[model samples]
Target: AEPDPLITETQGFAQSLGDGVDATPYGLPIEYESDVIRRNVEWLTADTISSINFTPIHALDGTITPQGCAFERHHSGAIDMSKDEYRLMVNGLVGTPLVFTYSDLERFPRENHVYFCECAANTGMEWAGAQLNGAQFTHGMIHNMEYSGVPLRTLLEEAGLPDDLDGKWVYVEGHDASSNGRSIPIEKALDDVLVAFKANGEALRKEHGYPVRLVVPGWEGNMWVKWLRRIEITDGPVESREETSKYTDTLADGTSRKWTWVMDAKSVVTSPSPQAPISHGPGPMVITGLAWSGHGAITRVDVSKDGGKTWETARLAKPGEKMALTRFYLDTVWDGSEMLLQSRAMDETGYVQPTKTQLREVRGENSIYHNNCIQTWHVKENGEAENVEVS
Candidate 1:
């Protein structure tokens, strides 16, 4: 073989001195990686203030989503609030109403846990059909991060709840203009919810509710109010507008199912999808994706190349954690043929992610929330892929 000039000759980078460590005091992704960023489809919403942006999941690997590029959804807009001005109020059904400032919260014992917060509408756009063109658009309305905060139980304990706790609920509201209040069952509020102040080892970004936010593990993202302002204990659910009108699941008969909180087990092939199509032709290819469950940890993930006709279990990068994203991969050889790629996730609760056919038959395609149906990507022989639906 002829000598490769690129390797044989001296390269510019190898011959010159590089930048010093202080060039960028606050580190950022190198310019070469500028393409990986949060994206928003203008047609999806009326304005930028009250809209959502998708994470570049196809360009990312592993389970934890980087805070910089994680998705953001806002009812009004991301507010700017300083820790000195933050306050959380606990009232209603408590022996004494108590208010705590940001400093007061820090004084409490804090704990950290990694959890995935997914919008109930993550895959809602595809419920009718293959609407979105990429996995990032269809399933990027989620992000997993290590949250550091005091548990909700700790705050409730300080407020002094009544001895009889049957059929109790808690109403949480944010400080944003829209308030975006949602009611939670007392059982869930006291179980694993947290008053999170930090994410991924850094102070919360302004777009992610800077000073403080509520982390409702295993529940829909809408319930995890950003810029958390108040928590009111009550005898029953508050039936707020967010719960009654927005997030409820509407069925074929026009009846709505309310209080449907937990996000079901779901997975999608990120690479070899519309956005991250294979550039290299055939041979020694790796198919990868992400799987997560709101109910529990993902126990297994199966990949299908022929649109559910056959299945092969994928390898998990690490053991699955409860309510967090799990990275899965399948090492194989591609023969330069067309493929209908799909993935199914099974969680510890024995609940299997359902196919679009199965989901449509039951829900009748009239709803837009809690859509955990399987997704398909049609990959061409030329290495391009597009969103697709199959029987």
Candidate 2:
């Protein structure tokens, strides 16, 4: 039998005393993990300024996405703004328009919750077919974080909203060059909307809307305005460029559906995928992935290897939470044979994740956002995986 590597084989890292904590001031992933970083589809966007990069979901596990490795969608490129120069204002239809400095936000009570932020276009590229070859590219436009900040309702209450909330909406905007404003119903703004300052237990990253951002759980990532600046209450939706020209789903008849915010239940396998192909030979293979729902908590996740011809329930790695990413796994033995790997998520409301065919049947192929279809991966005998569709 072979002895332990540390006892029999020599390694420089283990043999010598490494640098102390003071050497790193701030920590980062080791050099070996350089490949585990945000990636962008350069051809998809016109320029990096208003471009997006995917989170390396294939290289991650558990629910909390690391602040440094999370995905970023920059409308006008990431900015560097000082906390001293930040201001948040609550105007329109209020007692008196109130302004708050960066310091003022800290005085309010804080709350925390783990939530998943998914761009509605997470799987939009695959609407026609399995165009992307990796899970990171196909389903990486999402992230989960523990947000710590005050609820928007508290600030709205401070500004004193009208007693009759009907026919009222909140128009929120960011401070970046793009502004990225969108309207939200008064009901959702008062329900679970968060004015987040911290994510994953630290100050928000500049790429993830530093200084401050809005955390609209279960809604499309576009509505989660980063670099948040102002909130204006009004009687109707803003119908801004983002809501009208972009983000909306176009149906078969050339008409489009607007105001579609909630992200439906969806799931995707992470490991043994195209980007993270299996290196080890057949034996015990742990199939794992992330499941999330904007509608509510993920009730259950099911995995299928034969293109959904049969299904087996997968175990939730942890208890599911509302508007948060849930980890799920199916501990099984792979025989090194070919497999059509797939995952389906069921939300608390009993809504099941649909397939591309099912989605196209209802949505048609002309849409761009909110394509939460179940993704499929074709695994070959050599343990290589590719984005594929099953008949």
Instruction: Tell me the TM-score of each prediction against the true structure.
Output: 0.98, 0.98
How would you encode candidate 1's per-residue C-alpha lDDT over 1-391 as one tens digit per residue? 9999899999999999999989999899999999999999899899999999998999999988999999999999999999999999999998889999999999999999999999998988898889989888999999999999999999999999878889889999999999999999898988999999999999999989989999999899999999999999999888888999899999999999998999999999999899998999989999999999999999999999999999999999998999999999999899999999999999999999999889888999978999999999999999999999988
Q: Top lDDT: which candidate number?
A: 1
Q: Worst lDDT window (10 residues) for model 2?
A: 21-30
- How well is each residue in 230-331 modelled by candidate 2, as lDDT tens digits? 999999999999999999999988999999999999999997799988788899989999999998999999999988999999999877999999999999
Deviation of model 2 at 169, angstroms: 0.2
How big is the RMSD of model 2? 1.2
Candidate 1 displacement at residue 256 in angstroms: 0.6
